[model samples]
Target: MQNKYVNKVLKFLKWGAFILIILIAYTIISARITGADPSFMGYQFKNVLSGSMEPTFRTGSVIQIKLTEKEGTEYEPGDIITFQRDGILITHRIIEKIIHGDAVTYRTKGDNNDGPDIDAIPAGAVLGQYTGITIPWIGYPLGFASSKLGALILFLIPGVIFLVFGVHYLRGWRLSRG
Candidate 1:
């Protein structure tokens, strides 16, 4: 009787883990061939949380970013780009780029923003351009989970439930053998 549920759950876990592993491997291989590595540190997500780039990108968009800047190519004005600012990820358009010998300065602004950004963004601040975004509402959960409360709910609750389920599953296996 209990063996049936145990078998079902174990089988499900096996297949689920197998599929997840295969998908992850495939993603890694695809990234390598495409000249990118698509994983984040500590399983992070760099998402576009605001409507700063409208008519093209909306709020609740997941933008996969690549670290490590490419050199020798000067990004020009009107090129969309993403960059790290104070450790946070930001994506905006380059409205101006001034090349002074070895130094490069940039001015960036959001498309939907009223005016250009108040500050002049140096070339060092730019990361990369807007590559892609997931579906609108579908990415909301992801963006939300990156937040404080949502992180707790998304990670802690599921972790606790999985632990409880694992214990119950092992207990059932032991009881069945007795």
Candidate 2:
């Protein structure tokens, strides 16, 4: 009975470790292939930092955005978009659209804010439109994956775990041979 229980636990641990390694590999490969460019593949992921869009998407939410091209794309009222302002990315709803000759501008406001934004955003500065996919509270861990500590957590910890397991298995093999 004791040996049977030990075998089951070992099998479970082996499968769990295998899944963890695959997950880590996939994450790193996808991020590298995407090159951290928001415009790449017309899709990007961002972490919600504020309660500006509260009730719609709370803070610490992860949102996937699809980039909108300047041509053949019409800005509509009530559309959520991510744009760059003073080197920061802001996500808000478009309340109005203003056209000047060949150029277009957008009036945006946070869903939780009382008034529209002070300045209109030009079409050139727009990043992407929200695809309405929000995963709650995942942004915190994803945020960590972009930092030095994140690298340690994602790579080092797993590597260490695998190494310890390998050493233990080798020791068992040697004991069985002797």
Candidate 3:
């Protein structure tokens, strides 16, 4: 009974690892081809590149952003959002909202910063809102795996393991047949 339970647990672990590998491989390939992060179920994953949001979420953490249509979404103060400014993506909390005859802008400030950001961004610049889902410290490994060398190592090790298992299985089958 114990042996059977151990085998079942090992099988479960193997499947879990397989799924994780597939997700990582997909992320790497999609990012390289499209120059954009992949989204799943209306959510996108991004790595925190700075400590601006520390205490809420620290650097080296991976965050989930919930994608929404810009036209219908109404953002307010106290909500954390990810937006683009001068070609850079920034995540910050909305401290104030400015509106002028159908034009809307937001004043954002980082949680760890002393002052608000230098400029107010137009509503069109908003990308998504933070979903409060974070995986701590996994960004380092994910960042590495996105690199060329890291991708090779990521796939190569698993390939070799699968190859060895294939050979072993083939040998066992042949011996049983004989």
Model 2 lDDT at residue 28: 68
lDDT tens readout by residue for model 1, 62-138: 66544435541368888777776776667788888878888887788899999987777677776655545445665
Residue 172's C-alpha lDDT in candidate 3? Answer: 94
Q: Write the per-residue lDDT of candidate 3 for residues 1-178, one digit (tens) a residue.
A: 9999999999899789878878877876887799877887788988999999888999999999988576413889998999999999999999998988888899999999999999998888888999889999999998997788987997899989878977997999999999
- Deviation (Å) of 147 in candidate 2: 2.2
Model 3, which residues run further than 4 Å from truth? Answer: 1-5
TM-scores vs. true structure, each candidate: 0.63, 0.72, 0.85
**TM-score of decoy 1:** 0.63
Once fitted onto the true fold, the runs of candidate 1 whose alpha carbons sit more than 4 angstroms away are 1-44, 70-74, 84-89, 138-140
User: Relative to the true structure, how large is the alpha-carbon lDDT of every model?
Assistant: 0.69, 0.86, 0.88
Task: Report the Cα lDDT for candidate 3.
Answer: 0.88
lDDT of 1 at 150: 78
- For every candidate in turn, the CA RMSD to the true structure comes to 7.4, 4.3, 2.2
Off by over 4 Å in 2: 1-41, 70-73, 162-178
Ranking by TM-score: 3, 2, 1
